[model samples]
Target chain A: MKILVDTLGADKGYEEIVKGALKALENHNNLYLTFIGNEEEIKKLVKNNTDKINYIDTNEYIKNDEEPALAIRRNKKSSLHLGLKALNEKEYDGLISCGSTGALLAGATLITKRLQNISRAALTIVFPTEKNPCVLLDAGANMDCPPELLVQFALMGSVYSKGVLNTNNPKVGLLSVGTEEGKGDKLRKDTYELLKNSDLNFQGNVEARDLLSGNSDVIITDGFSGNVLLKSTEGTAITIMGRLKKGILGSFKAKIGALLLKDVLKDVKNMLDYNEYGAAPLLGVKKAVFKAHGSSNARAIETGIDAMVKFVENDIINKIEKELAKKEIEE
Target chain B: MKILVDTLGADKGYEEIVKGALKALENHNNLYLTFIGNEEEIKKLVKNNTDKINYIDTNEYIKNDEEPALAIRRNKKSSLHLGLKALNEKEYDGLISCGSTGALLAGATLITKRLQNISRAALTIVFPTEKNPCVLLDAGANMDCPPELLVQFALMGSVYSKGVLNTNNPKVGLLSVGTEEGKGDKLRKDTYELLKNSDLNFQGNVEARDLLSGNSDVIITDGFSGNVLLKSTEGTAITIMGRLKKGILGSFKAKIGALLLKDVLKDVKNMLDYNEYGAAPLLGVKKAVFKAHGSSNARAIETGIDAMVKFVENDIINKIEKELAKKEIEE
Candidate 1:
């Protein structure tokens, strides 16, 4: 499976990316990588392993100093631009970037363009809810979206939940402030009305608190709000867990007890960490594209690659097509 | 302080509402409560308690069973609407409602109307950040909003932070998917540009994970986004803590150790449980208003009343006007 990796964005330098690429190659030798970055950095990272990793000399890497969109506009040779351009030209089955996700997303839409009939692609994340992992879409993909766009997000997320999560009939929900029918704004109100008759599992409305309660499988909202909610949930969970670590294990005996229950603590930590799920799929793109978290470590990158490889091999595009066709029939 | 309480809504019905009202009245004898609901349901709880609690029968009690907006529209006697109407008529310093928040916000905007200078009213909640309490605005007040509306939210949030949180110069931040410039979509881009020139201690955009770490004193976003973030944060905190109580301290050794660390737990819980600070204040209204969680028990109810009492006694309205006028001069 062919996958393009932007080696400049992660906290680790090109060395780690090269090492990760080599490691990914060890498992899947047929795995082709198009590394978009400077030659020297890529060589330094790749060492003597040039056979597995292919380099694309972009000359310029959009620095954190520059503005994201403006950088994209001016720096055509930037790795972000080149990587997405290669993906746009169908050079790879999927594109993977750990760099400025916003830049990646921007470059993806403007370069490769969204899929047919898709208003805009959504970044869908699988959050670990109490019951199971639930799908949250448009977690800041396109901030200003129309009601029609949200409806599209619902359909796309619904298709994703069924295809990925293996839910036979995923209950699609409109994420609003409250669960009532007419709880949200004009956009939400319209989306809810559309979802009600649109033939998806249309679970009326879902509040943010209800996210972890497994009340619904597919929760759709605009990117801005979804992103905020997703991040806030992560922050709150981390803060609570941090407090538990500090507050409970502060004392000598408590600390000793915590050590005794270290296995339990590990289990608890695993439950909270979202990196286990790999990268978020940028659904509705022409080809499968995945975005790793900015703070993602090597393991997350590996998981993302594994997920992409599996997705590419699984022929999920056919599934997406079938789902869209089903949606058409319902409409 | 004269405060209006919607003596209706809650799964517990009018009995708990009135019972909580009586406790609220008993707790603060100087505080006057305009309890609007079915007179008899309130009477059953009010009994001979006539000193501060005055029952106002609006012939409307909003139900949770049906659509919220329609419920508010159909039930003219809904305590939620009537209570807001009283505030609109300049009958109280601030109104507190224990009804559906979506309905209260709708009623607040549609019935009470915003202050003359204010274009939109936001629901603001305070969270205990690393430093002082962090104020988050438009906590699900409206789902769809323009960039200018978010700019307005920042201004209003800054005013509230100064008045309520007692920050001399509260740093206002535009909530985004990331902290980088042009990191988000159209709304964020426009809002970021607008915030750069606005009359605020405008820090750059703040990411969700950094929200609780005190990246900014006041975080402003559209209601739909804010609401989801707030609820998710709250739910994550509660769910994780509950799991800790049951899972972490489930064993006998930990249980024995946990009692010794009760003070630590209490302190940590206090930090996590932001409601202890006050009920969420509805900013930008002509008259100050507060909305508490519908499931709020007695202490939370008192906290709501206490916030309103402080809002009234502190001359928060005049303070907001003075701040805005001063902001105008500075800008």
Candidate 2:
């Protein structure tokens, strides 16, 4: 499989992105990468030139402050726009970027276009759970969503879980304030009614507290609440872990204790750190694309590349298109 | 001061409730308590014939499954209903109940009535931060709120932080997906405009990740999102702490390390425990009312009573009424 890698917008600079792409290439001999950025900078960092590696020059890039929809329309020569345009042209099987989320979503929808019969694209994250990682979608794609849009998110999320996460008969749950028949606000109640009658394995309303407990394989909500849930959980974990560290280092006995429990601490850290998943896929787009973290290091970028390759190999985008088309036909 | 206590709805039974009330009575010399529940059960538990502890007979109680509005209208003899009715009649300074949240909210709103100029009653929680406790409002009251209602929440939350939490010129922030001026859904954007034009100390949009950072003294949002945020943080904390404990006990080295850091762990646990604060106040109501956790023990119950006493002494309800009236006058 071939992938287009946008080597800009990351906090670690071009060196880390290049190194990560090279490392990923070393592991997957059948995979090919086309780097999108400054050609000279890419040449200076990458020592070896092989048929597997390619480069596309684009000095311009979209900034986080610019309006997403307008920037994608205006910045034709920018790396983000150009990289997505290349993928749209079928130059590569997938695309990955650590750029402005707004710009990426706009480019993915407006430039590359959304999948057939899909109303809107959703940004999905695989949150780690006690059993396995669950797919949570519309992470921040559409801030305000109607009931129909949320129904689409549930269908899309289920497809991603089955295709990428390798889950069979993935259970889809609507995120709400309660687990009863008629709970949550108007949007949720309406969405619940729609989902209950759908073909997916619809588990009734799942409370936010149960979102992280592995109650369902796919949890769907609007972008605003989903984003808040994602960020709140992350912030709480960071704060608590920080407190735990400070507590351990506050005394002499605790300091010694910490040294002895280093392995266990590492294990817990790995369980909480979301970067282990590499990137969050922006699903419902016409092609396979991912948004890596802004502060992604070499390892995280390489992990993202591996995931993108798998997304292409698994034919997730096409699978989503087929499922959505089937629904359209039934409708 | 006089306080009305509902002796039903707790998971632990009448004996625990009686013990908790007695414990609270021991702490306050000039305080009187009116217990509302089964007359026989109360007589069996309370051996004291003191005039300070009084009882009212009520055979019925609201269940969690009953519709809130219907239950409040129908279940007149319920402990919750009778307690609220007693408080509404000016028989007590304040009220405390660990009953169905829906029933409590309905009883408080319908029987006690809302404070003048207040749009709706809000459930307020004081979340402990590194610096101090920050007040979060509309926790689960109104699932869907208009922009004007959110502005009221900000006003009420600020009053709560000032009167109860003792913060002067408290910073009120609108919770949203981003910190930008025009971020979040239509509700947040419109609320931002209303807050900016209002007299309150309005801080622009605050991300959910910053909710626990003590960045703002009061965080305001619609009940649906607020409930999700509250529950998500709680679930994440519980999951992480559980992982930490499991990891520690899984190995001998870590077990010894944990033994040495027992004091530190205790400190961290205390910092994260919501029970330390005892109860969350149901603000915007005419009376000082609180809803304790259903699983609350004797210590938690006592703490709730102490808080009720403070609420009456500070005249928080009256203070909120005055502030809200002043805002209306200015408008």
Candidate 3:
């Protein structure tokens, strides 16, 4: 399968993206990548895999601070815009970017377009839970989601969970203040009614505290709350880890313990590491689009590529289209 | 100072609340507590401290699932209602409840009432960060906050941070999706414009990821997002600790490390412990009202009482009222 890789907008430089792409190419002989941005640097990084790699050199790139829609419309020669355009034209099976999330979503929506019957595409994140890696979405895509948009997110999240994450039935839960039917704000109350009546395996509301407990395979929320949940979780993890490090280094006895427990600590850190989880898929778009974290390193990029390949192989976009179509007919 | 302690609505039984109250009485000689719960049970537990304790015997209480406004209005004889009423009438200096947050907020607003010039009261939580204990407000109170309400929350939070948490010139930040001025949804954008114009040492928009980093002394958001941030942070911390425990127990070598590092780990846990932090004050209320965690133990209750006493002594409500009145006059 061929993928268009946007090598800009990452907090880390293009070299890291290129290195990750090279590693992905090494792992899968059938995988082909088209690197966009700073052509000279990407070419130098992928010198060994020139046969399987393509390059679109451009120093212009959409910045994280740029307005997404305006940036996409204005910066036509930028790597993100160029990559999305190529993906839209069917030059690649999918697109991967460690760029601005807003810009990627905008370009994907306006350029690649949404699937038939899908009003909004969701930015979906897959994170590790105690029981399994669960799916959470619209993780900052549509901030002000109406009830209908939330319903669409729930349906799309369910499809991604089943098709790519390999969850059976994929119980969907609405993120709310409480687990009751009418627990959250107006949007949640209305969406709860809709989800309860849907054909999917709809679970009742799941509170934020139960997010990592794996109570449901697909946890759906509006982008605003979902984004807050995602970042708060990340922030808390960093804080705890920082505290642990400071505590371990504070005393002589603790230093000895830390030496002995180094492996265990590594294991715990790895479990919470976003690098292992790789990319978040922009689901409901006509073509497959995955967004890696902005601070992604080489390893995260490799994992992102692997996730993108799985998303393509599973035909998630087509499956989502079919599910929505089926629901429309049933209605 | 005199305080009314509502002994119902805690997930833990009234016995725990009684035990906590007893501990608080032992710690403060000049302090008085009115226990509002099962009269006979409270009497049995506080028999040793009867001199400092007053009993209002009533088993009636509001449940967590009950609608906040309706529950307060209907359950007039409930412990929460009686306590709020007594506090409202100036029979007590403050009120402490380990009861339903919604019921407490609603009762406090309706019965105890908001401070003059304050439009809404905020549910305020003081949590530990890397630098100091920062105050987060509207932590599930006003779910649908307009820009003006958020400005109110910022002011109230700043007051609590300075008066209770003892942070000087508290930096108030509006929680949003990004740190940029216009990064978040409509509410955030509008709130940003107002806060920027206000004289509350307004820090720009704070991302949820920077919440625990001590970037701001006061973090303000609408109740929905604030609740999500609060619970998600708790969930993530719990998940990490669980993983660390599991990892340590999985190997004998790590078990030895855990044994050696027990004290350090205990210290870390203690720092994050809600029991140490005591209770969250319901800011903007006319009378001092504090809400202890639903799972409060004896220690948490003791600390909560200490916090309540400090809040009353500091005269946070009067300070907030004056601040709001000044702002109104200036406008």
**Candidate that beats the other on DockQ, 1 or 3, i.e. the better one:** 3
Question: fnat, candidate 3?
Answer: 0.81
Cα lDDT, all candidates: 0.76, 0.86, 0.87
TM agreement with the true structure for every prediction: 0.85, 0.96, 0.96
lDDT for B190 in candidate 3 is: 88
Tens-place lDDT digits, model 3, residues B1-331: 8889899888889888888878887887779988898888777665575677787778899998898899999988999888888886656899888989889989989898787767788889988887888899888887778889989888988888888888889999889898888888899988999999999999899989988888799999998899999999999989888888988989999999998888888877876799988899888877888999999998899999988888888888888888998999989
Pick by TM-score: which candidate is best? 2
Q: Is the docking of candidate 1 incorrect, acceptable, medium or high quality?
A: medium
TM-score of chain A of 2: 0.95
lDDT of 1 at A283: 87
lDDT of 1 by residue, B219-304 (tens): 98877777777788878877777766766556776565556666666777888765576588888877878887777776677777
Clashing pairs in 1: A140-A223, B59-B77, B60-B77, B60-B78, B61-B78, B140-B227
Ranking by DockQ: 2, 3, 1
Model 3: residues >4 Å from true position, as ranges? A47-49, B47-49
lDDT for residue A130 in candidate 3, whole number 0-100: 83
